[model samples]
Target: MRVTTQNGRVLLQNDVVNAAPVISTSELRGLGMESVAYIRAVEVEGEAGFAIHAADGTPMAVTEDRETAINAILQHEMMPVPLH
Candidate 1:
């Protein structure tokens, strides 16, 4: 198991190919689900849109609509989490 931190969050990287590794909640704020992402509503240049970001808060992409943003995240094998 490899552990790294980015943006003050702990990230556990799985090194084993086919072995199932158990992780703790304190280990990852978001789990080992590789492509976890979240969507947020934003106004860019006076245009309403949705913005997709990685678990570490890195900007991924922006879409004009909510459905399209969700689809784009899913297409990339990323889980879209709701932000409050």
Candidate 2:
């Protein structure tokens, strides 16, 4: 039997499948507040902008520049992932 990981799930050539990995609340808490964040382009109040949000969905900042938004998250020591 051959096992491999794909998209956080385990797959076996013998026709077995494992569920996606899960993160516990305690484990997330241990990572400290706002350890991760997402940067997304958005239009708000009739203006186009980029927004940064914390892992818990809290709004961090909004700016007219995408790079500025991402850099702001990095300045806070948080991992920033761009959202399409």
lDDT of each: 0.81, 0.75
> Once model 2 is optimally superposed onto the true structure by TM-score, how far is the C-alpha of residue 27 displaced, in angstroms?
2.4
Kindly give the number of clashing pairs for every candidate: 0, 0
TM-score of each: 0.62, 0.62
Residue range with the least summed lDDT across 10 consecutive positions in model 1? 19-28
At residue 74, give the lDDT of candidate 2.
81
Cα displacement (Å) at residue 62, model 1: 0.5
Output the worst ten-in-a-row residue range by lDDT, candidate 2. 15-24
Residue-level lDDT tens digits of model 1 in 1-77: 67888666566778677755545444556664457889999999999999998776778898999999999999998
Q: What is the lDDT of residue 36 in candidate 2?
A: 86
